[model samples]
Structure formats: structure tokens, C-alpha cells
Target: MAGRRNGHAGRPRVGVLALQGDFREHAEILERLGAEPVEVRRPEDLRGLDGLIIPGGESTAIGNLMVHSGMLDAIRSFFYQGGAVWGTCAGMVLAASATTGPSQPLLGIMSALVERNGFGRQVHSFEADLEVKGFDRPFRGVFIRAPYFEDVGPGVEVLAEIDGRVVAARAGKVLVTAFHPELTDDTRFHEYFLREVCGSDERS
Candidate 1:
């Protein structure tokens, strides 16, 4: 484990995919939450990570980078070996089994059919208070060119939604959000991923 190797002991070492997007924001959050945040730019960076976070950005660009960097198959193998993952916004698009509109490279780890930019264009971006499952209060969801799930296969648990559209969901150790939580001050989503998904006991 990275924590043990890096002398962090019980702290979980989480990797943030840095190929594109607001990876710095995610890294800051993970660091503030007491976990070691590692920027994963290559397939070899996946080693010893307790979990991975795919940040919000251009899905097609990020997908292309992953393919060229040999990170596609590497991440798949990491996931199958019980690695936890959380995908936000465009990351959700890459994580889904299939997407509407354009054909793009995907991790196909999450069992959901997603509609890219299902909300609208960038100008239509907006925020909403979402009632996320397992949370004591509503979460402020920041939707920027967000995508929504048309459907999720069996075993996938819907976490939050807006206007009856699925905005957040999870299957086993993998979590996905149509909105950006790192953009907001609330760290509940990150905390949940650390404590619940990664099985980390560290309290933020």
C-alpha cells in the first residue's frame, strides 16, 4: 500500500487521474481530508493506490489520452483487482458502459447508459441542492455540462437525482456523479468515498 510505503500508515493513498481536467482541485480535497493524493499520469501510477478519482473535464480528450498512455487496460485491471473509483462529470461519461451522442473510449466499469451533456451546453450550467442517499442533509450539486444516466443495470444503487433524472449512483466500490462536488466547499462526497468506498477509517 502507498500509505505504508510512504509512512502514512493508516491513511489511504488515492490517485487522481491527471491526464486532463480539474485534477488539482480533487488532489487538494483529498489532502485536506487526510489522505495522500497522488497524481496518476501513467498506468504505472495506479500501483498501490487505495482508490482513484476521475475528475471533470472533456471526456473525449481524457479518453484519448488514456488510450495513448496505456492507462485504459491498466485501470481495468486495477478495478478488477478491487480498486475503488469515483468519477465526476465527464469522468462519469468515461466510466459508463456506453454513452449517447458520440462513440468514445470508456472504462466501461460502471453499468450505466449515460447521455453526454444531457443537461445542456456550458451556458446552461447550473447548481442544485441534491438529497444524496446516506447523507444527513442535501448536497449542493454543481452541474457544468453534466451528463445523466438514462439507465443503470442491476446491482447499481442510485444515490442522488435532479428533476427525476439520475445524477449520482454507485455499484460496489465504484461511484459516479453527474455533477462536480470538488468545485463546492462541501467535502461530504469525498469523505464518503474515502470512508465508504475505500474502506478508510480516517475522519475528515
Candidate 2:
């Protein structure tokens, strides 16, 4: 689906982690789809949101800011309460339970294990048409210093992959992509997150 109207009541209130990364891009996409986008810079900002997005940037920067701002626990509670979370690029690293190389602080909400910059350096960056689950058309995936899932827990379902490597995955209310869908015109992925993951919860 390209977009979904708030059939039941108000639009789903989605929060974008403003700690770092391309958070503004995500906010624009959400607003275009008719969902309320809240920029979350502090723990208080997390209140009264239906879903959240961790955008692509340096994972360490985002993680450190989250901890310093006391947003880590708040986010964990949000995810555990069935609030949907979508992590793009570096966001994937923070969302995963484990990662390749050095260990870093994570939300540890999803069951997936990710490898940071698994797609190689910026010179190796590329784009691919991904046939994501539940979408009829292929989605353009922009991989830039992206990370890929090396292992997934039992409950996790892979959405899209390239060259047999996991690039997108979902588990319960959480969704993650190694590529930056926000950088593209396609709002299908954001639509997918709101309609499917957020569901009918008007407050979300």
C-alpha cells in the first residue's frame, strides 16, 4: 500500500529519534503519509507516541546520546509495550541484540544479530531493487555504509535480502532495514510500518 488514512480516528503519532542521523528525512516521509511525526530528543519526547524510528547515522553517537539523555530505558519500555520501531542503516546496529566486532550498547529489542558496515565501505555503496514482503512492487534500497543481519532469532522473519545476505527483517512490532528508504521517494516502507505494525492504535 502506498499510504493509509486514519480510518478509526486520529493519525498514528510516530517518533523519530533526533539524537543523530537523518531524522528529519523520516519526519518528512511520515508527514507526507499523513502520520504525525514527533522528533524525540529526550525521554519526555517519547511519551504518547505510537511508534518510533532510529535513522541512519553513526550508531555509537546515537547510542551515547540516548544513554546520556536517559532515553534508553524509555525506548526499551516503548518497544516492549508493543510500540513499533523501525531502524534504518546505523539504526539497525542499535536495534540488534548483537553485532560483529566490538560490542556496543543496543536496545536489544529485536532478536537479530547484525554486522556493522557489512556491505563494505562507502566506495562499495550501491542500490538494489528489493522485493520486500507484503509489497507487490520492488522497493529501491540505498545501501550506504549499511549493516546486514548475520543471524536471526527464531521468531524473526526476513523481509528482503541481496546475494543471500539479510538486508531487511521484522520481528513482532519491530522492523529494520540495512538501506535508507527515507532517502527515496517511495513511502511504501513507512506506510508498511504504520499500517501493519502500528495498526489501529490511534495514540501510536
Best by TM-score: 1
lDDT of 2 by residue, 1-204 (tens): 112222335778899998788899999999999989999998888777888999999887788888888888889988776677899998888989998779778999888888898989899999999989888999999999989999898888899998888999888778899999999999999988888777633222
Give the poorly placed runs of model 2, Cα more than 4 Å off: 1-8, 200-204
lDDT of 1 by residue, 7-122 (tens): 44577989999988889999999999999899999999999988899999999998999999999899888877778889999899988998877799999998889999999999
Q: Model 2: what TM-score?
A: 0.92
- What lDDT would each prediction earn against the true structure? 0.88, 0.85
Tell me how candidate 1 scores on lDDT. 0.88
Which window of ten consecutive residues has the lowest lDDT sum in model 1?
1-10
Error of 2 at 102 (Å): 0.2
Among all windows of ten consecutive residues in candidate 2, which has the lowest summed lDDT?
1-10
